[model samples]
Target chain A: MIRVRDLTIRVGSFALEGVSFTVAAGRYAVLMGKTGSGKSTLLEAITGLRPIEAGSVELLGRDVTRLKPADRGVGYVPQDLALFPTMTVREHLAFAQAIRGWDRTPTEQRVAELADLLGIDHLLDRQPQGLSGGEAQRTALGRALSFRPRVLLLDEPLSALDEETREGMYDLLRTVHRETGVTVLHVTHSLTEAKKLGDCIFRLADGKIGEMA
Target chain B: MSSRRRGTTPSTGRSDVPFLVALGVMGGFYVLLIVGMLVADVLSTTPGHLWALLKNRDIRYSIKLSLISCTITAILSVWVAVPLGYLLSRYQFRGKALLDVLLDIPIVLPPLVIGLCLLILFSTPPGRGVQQFVQVTYAIPSVIIAQFAVAAAFAVRTMRVAFDQISPRQEQVALTLGCSRSQAFWRVVLPQARQGVLTAGTVAWARAMGEFGPVLVFSGTTRGYTEVLPTTVFLELSTYSLEGAVAVSVLMVIVALVVLLIVRVYGMGSAPVGGR
Candidate 1:
């Protein structure tokens, strides 16, 4: 479960004012917002990338408002996917495990499992440059899932894909959620994407979060 | 197949031809001037004379000292440049513009002025305190310090550009993937910066190797002591050994070309990886 209570963040002239939201455990929650609605900013605040001016971020029933990003145990896949260009697909998947001090055998097994789960095993040796949009998204998903964080923060992870590819990714994302039972907070402007994937939908507007009917 | 057309196009309608030709001639003349001098030196000096100059103990010592000191200066410059450049690139703070201008002073100021400033600093209380612990002025260490004063500015400039080119998004993603801030920097940012660092190092080394004014003023170009290649050229020229000076200049040119070649090769190999 993830809970953000009255989270307010200011970045230069833009501000997210007293925004709050909650996603039940294991639910695929979609956050709908227009451009410049502070969707990405809110996600960054949750991940501790952006400092909250007020209020708190709680993850899995723990107060992690002041925790460092690495200590927050939140997996984030930004809009760009932001893959490390120098690293191979395998390295990308293994990075979180290595950083979190996972044991080698289990880590390898987890990487293999994620590769299989994401259907990126064939692209394991390739770097980000060689990957297609769908493949890169899969690799990013695999990387986010590598550490098995309690919540996954997806910032328009499928926005760059074509219609066909986006459909595939939506299915893939839903399947992954059902299989792993990990909570997801997916941010997007696409109403269709929300209707198709969200167990719970929250609309973000005017720097506030309101649960949809 | 198109040779006839290619040969006639410039003469037919290209009004820029005259301007291009004039520009080319001026560029060629400037290059030829330097090349012609080097050629003239080569023609006048015999193999025996070059060998003797190379074998001179003072020249040999100066060459060795230049290589060692320049290499150290290059390493130290990059060592300082990386973190400093990252800070300058990624952060906004009060007096940042002033700090940037301060970093650039060594690059723009007359080298002798920098040497004078160092001399003045070392004579002060804090400078004397440092000198009491370790010799600086008129010492070999001063050669490196002087070189570093200018070379580090160049390195910092190169590294700032490098860090500026990398998106902070990559580092953020690394942090989200369980890397601490330092971990993200080392794993993500540093690897991307490797080519820039190498380029900065070589450029700094080349600059340090060729630096004369600061070394002369601050370190003192004493033979078998603090003399380096550029200082050796000065000493040789003062003694009316034009051949010896040209030889040293040629050696410096060769070293610079080799470093540049390495940088080119490195840049080529890493270009694809850094495309992001």
Candidate 2:
């Protein structure tokens, strides 16, 4: 479970003020917002990429307000996916395990499992430049899941996909959540996406977060 | 059709006659001037003279010294440029703009003026205190120091452009994937910046190899002591040895061409992260 209590973040002229939310363990929580609603900024603050102006963040019953992103045990997929273009898909999957000092046999097993689970096994040797949009998204997701993170944060990851591909991704996401039992906080502006994916829905408006019935 | 009609046909395109002529004449004159000198030198100087110049004890010593000093200057330049470039690219603090402007001082100033400034610094209280422990001015060390001051400025400029092209998002993702700050920099940032570092190093080495005024003024072009390629050319010209001067100049031209070729190949192969 992830809890953001009275979280305030300021980025230049825009601000997210006194926002609060919670997602129950193993739930797919979708955060919906309009354009420039500071949704991405809120996600970045949770990932420790952006500094919080006020309030605290707690993850899995531990206060992670002052923790670094790597220490928070969270996987983030930005809107652009932000894949390391220079690294091959295999290297990208191996990166997190290498950095976290995971054992070789186990890390290799995890990487192979994620590659198979995400259907990116065939594209592991290719760089991001050679990948199609769906393949890149799956690779990004596989990388995020390689370390077996406690929470997954996605920001409009399916926005670039076509309607058909988006549907496939939704199913894949649902399967990922159900099988791994990991919490997810996905940000998007599409009502259909929110309706399809969210077990608990939170709407952000005017720098405030309110839970939907 | 008539000759006049043929001339007016626009098949030649709307060429700016005067502008094209001017560009051709100006560029042609400069290229011809350099080529003319090299051609004239080759025609006048015999193989014996060129070979003798190369075999001269003083010339050999100057070549060795120049190579060693320039290599050291290039390495030192990159060593400073990498961290300084990263800081300038990533952070914003007080006086950052001023510091950026200050980095360009050596590049903008005349080379002789830079040497003059270094000479004056070494004579000052703080510099003199350091000099008491290690000799610099008018010594062999002065050659490397003088070359480094100017070459490092160029290297830093090159590295800044390199770092500027890379997105901070890449490093952020690395950090989120479990890399510490240093680990992210070493593993992610450094690999991406490798081409830039090579370009900077080559440019710095080329600049250091050809630096003349600063080494002459600060290091004092002592024969067989601090005399580098540029200073060797100066010494040859001073003694009216045109053949010897031309030989050394030709050597410098060859070295510069090699360095530039390496830079071009590396740069073209590994275009900066965000660049076209």
Candidate 3:
């Protein structure tokens, strides 16, 4: 569960004030906005990557407003995918578990399970540079899901893909949501993406969020 | 070919052939000048002079001091450059531009002026206050301080460029993935900057290796103590031993070439991700 109430954030000359929203546990939510709208900023704030000026951010019944990003327990996939160029896909999937000091055997087992689920089993040993666009997307998705976080945040994950790849990813994303049942808040400018994937769609404009039919 | 096609490229190209020749001639002239200088140094000095200089106790001390001071300076410069570079590349804060200009001051200042400034600074009360504990003026430590003043500036610029090529996105993602700021830096950022750190060290080492003017004014060319390679050349030249100076300079040139060769072999890896 992710709940943001009356959140206020200032980024440069732009600001979002008195914004509020909620993604019920296990719901796939998409926030749609124009290019410069504060969608990414809001997502970053929820993930504790950015500071909030007012109100509260609650995840899994705990207030994480003043918490460091490390303690937020939210998996974030930024628009660029931000893959570690030095690590292979398997390493990337194993990273969170390793950082959190999970057991070695369980970490490997989780990596294998995610690779199979994301259809990246064949690309596990390969670096991110070798993966195609959809392959990279799946790799990043696998990495985000590997830790079994309560909340997942994605920023423009499919904006760079072709039409065919986007369609494939929509199905994969649905499958991921079904398999993990993690609360998701995906941000994008595309109404079609919002309509296709979101169990609940929210539109952000002029620094406020409104529910969409 | 049609007249238009022939007239467009081949004929026009022929007309500008002299312009191309002019550029090549100027470039070739500079290369030839460098080659000629090396050849003249080789011809004007004997292997015996180089061997004799190498055998001189004081000159051997100068070589050892040069290695020690240069190594220390390179290590110190990199220690300061990495975080300073990361700040300049990653964040914006009050006085950032002022800080940027301040960092460049050492790089743009005349080498002699730098030494003179250090001399004057040491005479001030605060400088004197530190000096009371450990003497810096005309001491061996001044050699490293002089080298660091200039060498660190170059290292800072290289590290800034290195950090700039790597996007902050990776660090942010690492933070989101249960790693603290320092952990993200150590595990994610530093590993990517491994080649860049080596490049900075190489540049600092090379710059400090050749530092002359500042070391001269600040540390002095004391025979058994403060002398470095470039000052050794100057010391030989001052004594009217032109052949010995050329031989010592030839050694400096060889060391510089080896450092350059190493930098070329293993420096400046293009970061695979990040940037604008």
Clashes of 1: 0
Clashing pairs in model 3, backbone N/Cα/C closer than 3 A:
none
- DockQ of candidate 1? 0.56
What is model 2's DockQ versus the real complex?
A: 0.43
User: Ten residues in a row with the worst lDDT in model 1 chain A?
Assistant: A17-26
Q: What docking class should model 2 receive?
A: acceptable
Model 1 lDDT tens row, A32-143: 9999999999999999999888999999999999998988988999998889888899999999988878899998899899999999988999989989999999999999
The estimated TM-scores of all candidates read 0.90, 0.89, 0.88
Q: Which of the numbered candidates is closest to the native, going by highest DockQ?
A: 1
Q: Which stretches of candidate 3 lie over 4 Å from their true place?
A: B1-40, B46-48, B120-135, B268-276
Per-candidate local distance difference test: 0.90, 0.89, 0.90
* lDDT (10s digit) by residue, model 2, range B98-134: 9999999999999999999999999999999989999
What value does the lDDT take at residue B92 in candidate 1? 95
TM-score, chain B, model 3, is 0.85
RMSD of each: 5.2, 5.3, 4.1
- All models, DockQ values? 0.56, 0.43, 0.51
